[model samples]
Target: MNLLFKKKDTTMKTIFLLLLILIALNIQLTNAQPTSKYHAKLVALDNVYEGDVDLNLYGQNPSLVKMEWTEISPDSTKKTIHRVQYDMEAVLSFIIDKDTFYVKNLVDDEEKVRPYYLVRKVYGNDIVALYQYTSKEGVKRIYIGLPRRDPYYVQHPFFTDGTNMYTAFVYFKDCDALYQKMKAEQDGYWFKKGATDEQCVSIWKRIIDEYMNCKK
Candidate 1:
């Protein structure tokens, strides 16, 4: 009886060791995967909310954006992440040069001409789009109109410019499926249950880094 009990104990210990090794290998494999090539960061003007009006269009707020640009994939298959921090206000405004792009407020059918809450900024050769994140009424909500393409425009839009502004269209349209997938992966370790806004942003940056770095 004593010998049988000892053998059972040894078998359990061996099984536990193997499980640990397997877990380690899985983690290693996950971290060693591949990512995409097109990535850019707007590093200079993070907290400069009150800078020159031309420079900071989405006043008194900060946001981070990430995008996956792929031609072979469908537009819906691409991903964009926008994380923002700002005061709780009903509407936000912005301005763009006439040559850049035209944004119409579909709510009013009026062209966005004044310094009201618009999401994208286009200057010399670059475009920046902002998305204000909210979780009170729902999960990850922001609003903006699509850019009106200019035939004479020279610079192509960065993925951040084109995709980040369309948060509802790009993300929340299928948010339920995404949320479920994010929750199931790594037992929701990246942005765990009941995560704070800052924590969620951090997780987004981590995900972007992994995607950009070609990691699984």
Candidate 2:
């Protein structure tokens, strides 16, 4: 009788342990599911798509964009989840939360094209744009894109020392004059020691507006 009771107790403990393990696995799987959605515009498609969008990278370069969304039929009777992948070149832009991102072609010193998402667009138009990119390693870079010119990296004036100061103002072929003008004004106090990030962004917007006016 004593042996039988001991065996029963042991079995009960084993069952409880197994149940706990199953519960832990279920929780982990639930947490692993993707939940965030984005608004995306593709170069090939005219209509905008609202979905869960991911930038799939291949060896540190963006190879494609994966999108998943549910479509409801016209009759409102059926809903199907659709999953699609687009080549990196096919994606024009996407908005996650409230921030907009554009596809930027990053060219190396050897002139090879490496595509990455421009994380932020400080200023942009048909003719020229200023964009910021954050790499996988969390390094941030600023870029200026212009017609007939390769998208080139520029030293961020607010974040770095004023070395290569003119690079930040190279929005046009004749921007040398504008750079000199801003330089005289201390480049909107960007070179000031211990300037806050918010202050720097405000100064950049003002300078970009001034530069854009010169192009008009």
Global lDDT of each candidate: 0.33, 0.60
- Say which candidate scores most in TM-score: 2
Tell me the deviation in Å of residue 16 in model 1: 78
lDDT of 2 by residue, 79-176 (tens): 99998787766666676656677767765434565555454676767566667777557776656565655455543332345654445445443666
Write model 1 residue lDDT over 65-139, tens digit each, in one string: 222233433557765444433331222332233322122132211322222222333221121122332233544
Candidate 1: residue pairs that collide: 33-214, 33-215, 33-216, 34-214, 35-214, 92-117, 93-116, 93-117, 93-118, 94-118
User: With candidate 1 superimposed using the best TM-score fit, by how many Å does residue 144's alpha carbon deviate from the native?
Assistant: 13
Local distance difference test, candidate 2: 0.60
Stretches of candidate 2 exceeding 4 Å from the true structure: 1-45, 56-62, 73-77, 83-85, 108-112, 155-208
Using lDDT as the measure, the top candidate is: 2
